[model samples]
Target chain A: MLLFFLRVINYKKNNYYYNKIEGTIIFLSNFAPMIEDKNTPKTSLSELGEFGLIEHLTKNFEINQKSTVRGIGDDAAVLDFRDEKCIVTTDLLVEGVHFDLAYMPLKHLGYKAVMVNLSDVYAMNATASQITISIAVSNRFPLEAIEELYEGIYAAAKLYNIDVVGGDTTSSTKGLLISVTAIGHANEHVIVYRDGAKENDLLVVSGDLGAAYLGLQVLNRENEVFKVNPNAQPDLGPYSYLVERQLKPEARKDIKELLAELEVLPTSMIDISDGLSSEVMHLCTQSNVGVNLYEEKIPIDPVVISTCEEFNLNSTTVALNGGEDYELLFTIKQEDFPKIKANPNLTVIGHMLDKKSGMALVTRANERIQLKAQGWNPIKE
Target chain B: MLLFFLRVINYKKNNYYYNKIEGTIIFLSNFAPMIEDKNTPKTSLSELGEFGLIEHLTKNFEINQKSTVRGIGDDAAVLDFRDEKCIVTTDLLVEGVHFDLAYMPLKHLGYKAVMVNLSDVYAMNATASQITISIAVSNRFPLEAIEELYEGIYAAAKLYNIDVVGGDTTSSTKGLLISVTAIGHANEHVIVYRDGAKENDLLVVSGDLGAAYLGLQVLNRENEVFKVNPNAQPDLGPYSYLVERQLKPEARKDIKELLAELEVLPTSMIDISDGLSSEVMHLCTQSNVGVNLYEEKIPIDPVVISTCEEFNLNSTTVALNGGEDYELLFTIKQEDFPKIKANPNLTVIGHMLDKKSGMALVTRANERIQLKAQGWNPIKE
Candidate 1:
């Protein structure tokens, strides 16, 4: 079934076989161009070489985080996070398995790649300060294509106040791949882990769920429509929110600061990358607790409900199983609930339970369905 | 021309295409097996799932570093270096681009991958502490195959006394790729950078050069021989050192301590990753100092010299242009020369000169030849 989406678009004798797996791509390349526009000049990557490519691409990056003692030019990046405990996390994005470049713009892809890793750092409740981006690209990618990718990466670093410490850039055999490692720091007492939730802790989530997944749905449908007719320009006004969520997922860097201002330290925390249910299961399994998640309490955007109806997808299921939201999911103490209750950015979704009670979602009609982690493990399928 | 090395082995109706790019692959998978070994049981990776595969692979990886506050099973790994500064380095090894499984073993590839990154950390004059490994594998890799790869990773971690802190595992469309992020720490005063060398400093290098490159040549030659004659068991006793250097190169972790013991701090340092010439040019460019490298002073193992003679290649050229030596090259004040003069492990190959003097290789015959960086950039070729 996955093979059905693999389409090849040959341009200038360059064959790009788009392998669309269930992945939100970070394609920061400008490979996609307007048809019949031969004015888009292309320079071969061979002209720049590896070192020249690295220097040219990274010359514009500025170090904002003081923790980064040295970046780029050295064999390794030197970081001084002071006395604060350091948090490190990494994620790899493969072209065929994690992205569909047919519809996904390369610039958004680069921004999303950095955004995904920062989300993990914020999930640790630490202040993300530095990142290393290593990418493997095929020779088909010109120097200009990589420049577009780096532009997005530089923009993300500048806006998020993170430093691009160091990275490796090499050629891949067939396709493009990106590996990003994010480093953050925080005081020992303020740090949070997934294994700390108490039985009665209230489950809280920032922002709505399922929009990113819906955005992917919209993108796939549009891409299909385009493949059928190149000139077709379907209005995407209604699906803009979902499409934006899918393409340019901003990490919840503010959620950590917002929680601090509210004076509510979550007992445990995780990022909503692989849908709500999967993240909830991770917290419960790691914390040795159960949760009573209210399906109605799931904070989803109005557009998500309306779009889900249009696509014949159950909105609750989408929230529970639609991955790549990039929102923070955590459990706060009941007393701290009063502090976060009136916040528009926060939503109280459920309450933690004893291990034996198990994880279940309470339906609007009061029906109880056992929760299961439906993480999109494409390798398994 | 690269297409000449690509070969496919069809077994069990599965097509295993070997893309032999000029890279040392960290395969760490038992994908290549002894012919007619049908008894070798194989379990599909899908059976383990993403989380299960991670848990199973890392179950044996015991955290050895004190800096690792938390390893695996979290959103991010927590590390505390206390007053010491943190050093981070990352490298991505892609199959086809980096290594040819036709000759490289999975275990050695895994160890070599970690070794390659650790070399960068040691070049910074820091203590290698922790590492995060992120890998993407195709469905072709079975559970047992990846287990072999991890065994090598675990072997390297255990031997080097580093912690396997965190990582992400996902599927790739084809082949296997491993990205290793090494984190280390050192006191502020002791940390070194590549831009600190001054004119009149003595240029030095640890161990010999060109052996790793010769090792690859031997392997590639042997692989071609094997393709023609499967039953032939050619003797490799003479090239053991070269083969070992290529397959299991060790990072110079003890150099920093040794230098400290001798009270000889390097003015600037870099690792021999892109050959001696490229690295020297970088030091000169960054530190604003030129170097007069003596050709006769180059320390080459007898095996490398013999192999170079057999291959009709110039030993000096190989030492200068052949890379992946994993040796640390640095410069020290002229006053520190006496301290290291008696040490057999360290070799003084040249002297730093003023920027106007320019980078040159003073040949054994007394001819001064201008030096140029001949980094093996496969992308350009």
Candidate 2:
């Protein structure tokens, strides 16, 4: 079991899979599967209770945000941010709608939940300091299961150096639901909104897009195959990057740092959670500027391209409409281009045009077409 | 129909019932049944879309918090609190777990949700300034139904002088889930924690107790009756105060103000949420002290007492263990008692003792008994 666990780490540092039948964390290996026996005990949540469960999970986390005066144990967390304005954003994710537990690991679910909120904070060029996670889970889950969830939450919180403040934990009537509120601070001079883009401002995106969406497709396919044949092993070696992007996608915490180091401030910014096209449209609509996005310049990872081909889907379309990338899309002044020109992660996809240009995308074939926001609406799905 | 709507207000200011079958909000009238006709139009959520639905719901909310710089319509809300420390708290409410839609009004649910968070902030002797609401609803809800929900949210926000900042609206996999995050500000000197209580400190409570819990009992009983007969009209006339306490319970926002006016700062404070007994235990455990609460002094509303008798429950027991009162419970210096002695809403119920003394209650009959926290655990319920 130890050797198999080490082998699983060789696949991904955080790739531990949950064995539903045995109700334990394990890893798949070529030699033998790592599964705890069914006789292993599962601690009921009622045994620890709500407050005890919260304390048990959050005890390992230390408050490090300078603004965070108190966390976790108080009726309300306290903070003092006198130097900058505080930015707050919240997101709610419901099971079956925002995620499918069948393919999504609990730890990855926790990490992704935090990333969703932090990405919004970074979009405003703010340094995220604190987050409160509110979860409603049914009795179907054990205390150990919630521990797995919070382990992921702590992993993300530590990675981003944000404090885990106070939140409420309640029983849900049905499936799991997660709500996260991210608090950040930003100086008035450095703050950015979606309405600041000017005509001719260069549109730039950090990192490649669409891999997370394709990764979801791969997981869904594997899930279907597993449902059909429980004994079949999923060989996810080739789609590691894509799968990681989907599972443990990182927020653009470094992008703000890089921009500061390079002395470049974005005129307008938004994160690419609802895909590039929707985010671009939001910037355009808010900033009163149109955009000319070249199809060839839209960043696409090699894995995403190959997977798109394998799935018989258009890679460019996938990049345009595939959601949950958690990448930053911002418009910077043309004069600032020189500072970011050599950066491997930064890609200039387009330039903002006058509003009368009507939000068009100039294709590589020299044809112009209007852009539409095909945002991920799980309600419809 | 218009006359019935007007009558609903005469019955109670926000007396509106949800028709589960039609998935619409209708005013309840004692004279006539509120069943919707089959010909009534039901607007699909797809018609307004997500963005349109949000805009329609939040357009009426105005930013009133001086600290709030930007609200709604942005990636994140911005707040500036330069002079004081910031306080943050969050709560999650799930349908069937926290409330039953059969009896609870959406607007009341919204108002109660905000009260839950604001109560926490006030417990720290902080002034709440801003709130963010995130909700996940199923397709069964129509645009108008959500409007009623937001109507209640805005009503609470307006009454409390809190700014409605940023929030997320999404589709739920099952029932409705609402999450609220409240932010407040306080001077470091004024801020109090649960661990600040000391031996001989006077323990005081604001307003009356047991009414909210009794109100829930009234609602639940009426719901059972209504379930058996859809046309049954719950007179609810005599139990108005109890019902209101459960539906639109006010947070003790004025407790901080009252304390300041009386020139008596609490050494330790906590909100009475999960029953007075549980909250008292929390304070004692955190402060490493014991408490002697006098049952004779425990504030119980006459209506609650009468209702407890009607339901065959002990009024004193309800006062100790009934939750959702949203009242302020705190410890103040014994010398400061003279300042609040004349205040009708304030009751000096007990005094703190050394940790070795343990927690005890002195009954009206002069009998001393140990106190136990029978907190409401909806998970078990």
Candidate 3:
């Protein structure tokens, strides 16, 4: 079992053909895929608890920047900031909008609230430092429950070394709302923007994708089973990787530091809160470039593969469209590829193309297929 | 009217108080007459539009410190942090809770949002410098409305001379929500905390109070009229003072600088956001002291008094309990009292007492009445 675990972990690190997934495994866009077949019953947000949903959502993110200092693991992320420039970002999470509290534990909700803001600061290639959290909660929440929420906040703060400076506590008319602002500092020269990737730059990602989405699928299935028979225990066996990815997603602060250490400045970068396909499109559209990804290069975990097969879903589709992978999708110059190739955590999936070439995918059969983005659009459907 | 206008303009410079109805007058709290009935129909917030409400709320705010280079008037408040210390504060405003969009204009909402955050920074006796804003809105809002909101934001930013450095935009499931974080700096030596007031220190305020609350009442009344008969023009003529108080409130950043130039360092300071009475209570409780506020010295604007009379409410009660004045409530040593006494804008309202004495009010009829806080409590109603 130890050897098997090691092999599974090192599988992507070694160059080996694991399966015959059809879609291109390369530089896809950042949006998550939507399996819009009427046969698959649509689920309402209330069906999955907040924790289960967040776990389902963030399964495939990989942190790629070292300045990310601390990622999804803290109350507020910590960044080295090297010297000079400091940046902070925050967002408000309102119930019925950001998440449904019915399925989300107050603790995980607090944790995820902080993570969402910290993700933005990380996207700037800066390290997060301090945060102020404001919460408006209805009287429905007991003092003990509020304490549980703070426990999660305090735990993440300790893990990230962020100071909980000050915030307002007010009564809300409806459900719970959380707003967190995170601050960080970095050397002005080192900060990366979304508009820096160039044609021919190698597109790379850290770690495997699509597990979080599959994890959500498994949880959803289990939730349905329990609904039918309350006595039925959830069979989450073999879905540990996906479940963990969903529950406590970590930001890619380490990857930021590794890139700096390797002296590889990514031309452009963004965190994969959305799926790989959506994020890739963001990079492409922002940089005014196209990309060509090879399906053979996409990383897929063994558990994800087995789970996808069990669920009768395409592993390639899951990897391509799965969201919340917090992994870094960045482009490095072709000349730096030799140095980056040695990093076990780094995966070179595709290359940037001219805008006219458009975004395409190379299947396992070596046939080129055009790639289109179908991310989660709350407004459209 | 010309003479009155000139006097008002000059009051800005000489700090003189003219008793003219439309000009400038410092409503001394110590001179207010005591009322027999305490149960005056308290004003309701729902009556006022957001802008009118903010204007009414900040009318009497006084700037007392020199380092407070800029107070409530900008995108982010400005302060001279070069020589002193600085502190930053922020808060989030959510629709359906913090405000109702049914009556709020995007422009005023944007301006008021920045002002609210700057108030906290001023409460710390620091001047604001920079601000970052993050907003989440549902699709129900149009692009033009968003632009209007930005116009208000940029207008405040430009007026305050603070750059709109960064912010985040995302979709919300509910109405609009704005979160503003402001940064300010002050001299470390001159920095004042809420807990620094000493026994017998002189209490001072910059301007009058209760107008904002009254303005809220007026707007709410008008709103009700509009709701029933959309064609009914808002009968706001008599309550213009209150309306302005609520619609376009300004921070007293200028007063902070004047205090520095005049060489007065307040022993303790806090913004009268909750109301003069509540703020005094906060300072006294935090400092482990009591206060003796002379009713006659509390500044009550003639418009506020007339409006209060029209509404059958005592001017004294309105001045004492009305909230959102954003005026600085501060205490100074006996020695500084003489310097401020001659100044037109500053009014000595009361003095600190030992903790054993507790907080009390000295009525105009020489009666001792205990002061109680009846400021805005959103949760109660």
The residue-by-residue lDDT of candidate 2 on B1-381, one tens digit each, is 311121123232222221111122222433221124455555666777677778888999998777988899888998999879989999998988888766677777888899999999999999999999998988887766677788889988998899999898888867788999999999999999999999999999998899889988987787667567757666776787777778778898878988898999999999999899999999999999998999999988788988998999999888888899999999999999899988887999999999999999989888889989897865455
- Quick one: how many clashes does candidate 3 have? 94
Instruction: Give the TM-score between model 3's chain B and the true chain B.
Output: 0.77
- Which candidate's TM-score is highest? 2
lDDT of 3 at A305: 91
lDDT score of residue B230 within candidate 2: 59
Candidate 3's residue-wise lDDT over A184-203, tens digit each? Answer: 65565767766688999999
Candidate 1 or 2, higher lDDT? 1
True contacts kept of 1: 0.89
Residues A114-206 of candidate 1 have per-residue lDDT tens digits of: 999999999999999999999998887777678777877987899789999899999888778899999999999999999999999999998
Q: How well does model 3 score by local distance difference test?
A: 0.64
Between candidates 2 and 3, the one scoring higher on DockQ is 2
Q: Rank the candidates by TM-score, best first.
A: 2, 1, 3
DockQ of candidate 1 against the true complex: 0.67
**Predictions in order: lDDT:** 0.84, 0.83, 0.64
Q: In candidate 2 chain A, what residue range of length 10 has the lowest lDDT sum?
A: A16-25
For model 2, how does the per-residue alpha-carbon lDDT over A150-206 read when each residue is reduced to its tens digit?
878998999899899978787887788899999999998898999999999999998
lDDT of 2 at A146: 78
